[model samples]
Target chain A: MSTSSDEPAMGAKKVEGAGEPIPPGKPMTMEQHIVDKGAMMLQRLKPMKQISQHGCSFAIYSHDMTRQIETHHYCTRINQDFLQCAVYDSDGSHGRLIGVEYIVSDKTFEALPPDEQKLWHSHAYEIKSGLWVNPRVPEVVVKPELENLAKSYGKFWCTWQLDRGDRLPIGTPALMVSPQGVNMGVPSPELVRTRDLKYNILTEAIRDSRVEIAEPEWLNPMADYWKQHGKGFKIDVEPVDMKLRAPFP
Target chain B: MSQHPEVPGDPTATTTSLLEKATASIQRFGPISHIHQHLCAFHFYSHDMTRQVEAHHFCGHLNEEVRQCLIYNSPEPDARLIGIEYIVTETLFDMLPDEEKPMWHSHDYEVKGGYLFMPGIPGPVERQDMEKVAKTYGKTIHFWQVDRGDNLPLGIPQIMFALTREGQLYDELAQDVERRYKVSFAAEKEKRKDIEGPEMGRHPLANGAGKGLQTVLKEVDVKPPSGTTPRVFV
Candidate 1:
């Protein structure tokens, strides 16, 4: 399902801007911020990095170029929501990416496959109540797409370009799951919940209005994860203005 | 190799000029009447809403609330959420000068005035507290222009916001312009001349009319007519 070949780490700070080259650095945690070299605020979250030292690896992808990665999914069940994002590396590859679950509405959840009910519970298994827990992906949904990339370029992703003056705002990002996988829009089953104390604080953190971009805190539960294994990997992120329309096709 | 030549994207050397040549034939033409579909990005502070507005009023829409929902709810089958206005950035134009008044003016009171009136200097502003100068004072209104690829303050946005998301007042005017100038012009040209070729012809009554008619036409040139105040805000 994954694309082959793991390029050296990228230098991009905000992965949104096109034409900019990536710089380099090791991923480290500093408060909520994922401090690294040359990265700027992605406007997606206050502290852009969401790396956890736990077994689950969080992957992040740049929004600028289509860095090689495994399978991609066009979420069907979800009625076209928006996704805000940042980039992360796992397995130490620049593309050892994981998407820190992006934003979507509750109405987006009601319509999904029953298998997700079980899978989502698995992802949020560690959490307590009052706060909504994350959903988990079922093995059926995750399997084939979970296959490792030919090399090890993890998932690449980012949010929709909602602010435009000339065209229909772009839709949210698609998940780069494995090749043979299906994308059920905003998998309600696969989302994870927050620790109650951290939930309110993280919520406020979102509003306090800081910005972040890199971290390997979250994992896709898919294989080929490097962060969970505690391997030290250097990554790079940069902002770019990529005209996403295609002639490249 | 590819047999077809590449289509030109920059309109100034292409679309705009073509419209100009068809002033009399088209039913419509204007900035707002244009249709586009593209993508863009924008930023909005949490302050834009309130618990009085929303319970988590001051909480963030970015990392927190929305993500929380996504993490918890986990959409399925049809996960793609449809059209919803997440964060809207209506360009807030602040304190405009007299020189810029001829074509544009959206008043903003926060920047109070006292004119020293120096040559080529801009108009003045007097404020009680510079700290009080949050960006809340400016006026956000419908802005229009013909240049598509022009550099805009916000990066290139999607097509819906730029074309279809216009406020009501600008919507009517934009439609009027398009109908009268672009569409009607083409139809008229097709009726009277070779639709296959590009040409601007003499007026019906002026057919075979002399240089005098041509001179009168020059005198009657149309200005970019401004309509009566159309309350463009919702």
Candidate 2:
């Protein structure tokens, strides 16, 4: 994996002449120019080889899957049948090879840009809502498209809940995506209508399986990272290398 | 009115409101299970005969009547090490006895001594730490407080086998597979009534047709608890 640490890189490349430089106002070619610009941006992108367990977001659900679990990566869903998955290796701890996630929801992939999508497996995306792949199981379901995708692109459908609360929980090299799917938007569970400790009804309506964002604020308390700039912790890792991991076939 | 809350119904909605709803509904009927904020610290008393300390943690919290003195009074020093994982330490990782110690170097799960030991790593704190308590203070020990973070699993088997050394577990399980795959797994499906999955081996004896299902064999269910997916432990 290319380990580059750059974000919001230049969108165009200037062609230099002997004396004059042509402003990259418009690209000579669309695809090639875009690719070159992307490569340059990726190269110039400052890679942060550190991962924090904070500011991460998460979601969870259960569904079918039909793909062989490759090595180099692991099926972390407590219940594999439904693809309860999580991914949070971006903090540059082990680089990208460490925290590869699978079976992300359509919602998650939709948030990605085109380049980011290519960086992730093509077949990875979300599915229907309302279903839960409980945190304590080892089950899965395989759809036809998912099976083919897993075979062709090494991507399969998975259902999972991850805790991408923003920063690492511990605020160090240990970024954990519980895959329990933290709903940052989950309304604060009001005592609502409590007849007693035993009898009550909820007043506020919510969507999706609600989970209390323990961090309520997307901050991760654990990622109080030491200035590893000159530290041996993340001495030489590139950013993109910190994003993708090697999948064992 | 909206027919339903929406596709992604709030999971937090079920947190305690449903409990309230159920409890209220239950009160209308009659008194039920004592629903108090109870701490179920299940304890495994040190067996008198074995002279070994076996710590068995269940899906509960510590009770007031727990025997904390079982750390000593053993035939073999640290011979019987029973580990209990998933000790409801989700919110109390820092509350464990010795939370201030630092780990040398750890891979996968973080090392927390005084709590249940992970498979591969050395028992946190070494003998000196335990010796201090075992040799003095009447060997009083408290339950390990652990954090059930996202990566680690809190499953039954995973928790059950928490305290075991990783190398030891790997060796034993390999041997178990060898024996099963070599012998018991070879019996005919109709005859190998004991074997469950293809990975498992067949039972030893076919016996006869008249023996019935129970007499023939049984299946082993390695299924995890409901709701969650299986954890991929390193």
Candidate 3:
């Protein structure tokens, strides 16, 4: 199997102007330096402890199918049907926290207003095609979870354009989608191969194992609107008139 | 891994438990180790003040002046992820365009009033961080409306606002949080009297002062023709 770590052919083109590292500023004072060091040691971080699952998957820009990114999800399942994930560029301490994705079951996804439904993409193809995986856990142990996720839908928002080599998170958040099929080359073979090589797993084997996980027939027609309408949502900053209210003196 | 007895009909529960143990390990969650602060607060709908929701913020500092947070309905293990809040320093907020300022709400009121707090950290230790937070401004978007009793997060995302003045927050809600967390907002507010507010004063357009704002999702070309940006409808 090819183990090339080269960038995808599409990423060669600069999408957004890559951000430069923040320039060094004035040196910190003795007090500023000591206080900064002390703060980290004194506080107890409890909320971060709630994250209970890790899965790796690939996503395409909902607005443009050609742009794709590998997502590392550290998730918290609020119930049997709902999950929220903190997505990163890699499964390492230095990986950029690029975005967040929320997953809901078929019943929940079906309940959303049609326009809202357009913002989410189904996980059926991702699961069955072996594009989504839980790393480090045995397949037997992770099977049930994958079964639940296969019937789910996700709404992902990307804050950092790491794929374009941006040094910092710039621009408005971009909505993301899961590739519904291989026909459009959304999850390009190279991308899947890169991930498979890194994890030491075989995509074809995983795909064979997930064949019994039946696809849900209740998928909302409006979901994955990018594919359906050939259009996507784009967020931007535009100028506006001012309205002011005075504050307390 | 801990063992579980086989259920009457279902058979995957044991494997599921083991899966949970594997993923929950610190080694597995190492990528998100930077999430080090937990701030509990409340948010009211930007378009409607009467619709209030408690927000528990699990945040990480991206730099000295910026922090990103995941807002959940509660701090419990099964808490619902209702929204996201991005906090920026006055410097960064000032760089935003005039039209974008209204989307952000100042933290002065929430922080100084003790309406925002750290759950398990010591008061003195947490207070130091709160001092920095007091000068920050947050732009929040809530996807789930727990107050509306929606079993799941539904409809389009809504812009959220922080309480700017006293009495704007519901009395019953504050009392309930006080009762459950065993922390008095009144006392915390009194102790935080010395934290300074922004030196340049609050942005007039912030907190949706005179008019409220709501997010309207419109379908447009993902990449608009070059040099022409889509018009934003407020």
Highest-lDDT candidate: 3
> Residues A80-193, candidate 2, lDDT per residue (tens digit)?
121212132222222111122333334443443443333223221111111211111111322222222222111211111112211101111111122211221121222112
B139-234, model 1: which lDDT tens digit per residue?
111111112321111111111111101121123332443343232322322332321110122111110111100000001111111423222211
Q: Pick the candidate with the highest DockQ.
A: 3
Model 3: runs farther than 4 Å from truth? Answer: A1-19, A22-47, A94-98, A107-116, A159-174, A182-185, A189-205, A208-220, A234-249, B1-15, B221-234
If you assessed candidate 3 against the hidden native complex, which CAPRI class would it receive?
incorrect
lDDT per residue, candidate 1, A108-219, as tens digits? Answer: 2223233221111111211111111111322232222122111122222222211111011122222222111111111122222222232223323321221221222332
lDDT by residue for model 3 (B196-229), tens: 8777878886775446665555566544334354
lDDT, candidate 2, at A40: 32
- TM-score, each model? 0.18, 0.17, 0.78
Candidate 2 regions off by >4 Å?
A1-73, A77-99, A113-115, A124-249, B1-234
- Off-target runs (Cα >4 Å) in candidate 1 are A1-157, A160-249, B1-80, B83-159, B162-234
Compose the digit string of candidate 3's lDDT tens values, residues A13-107: 35344333321122334543344445445444444666788889899876555678888998876555677787888887546667778897787
- Ten-residue region with minimum lDDT total, candidate 1 chain A: A121-130
Tens digits of lDDT, candidate 2, B71-158: 1111121111122122111112222122110100111110111222111112222222222211111111111112221121111111
lDDT of each: 0.19, 0.19, 0.70
TM-score of chain A, model number 2: 0.19
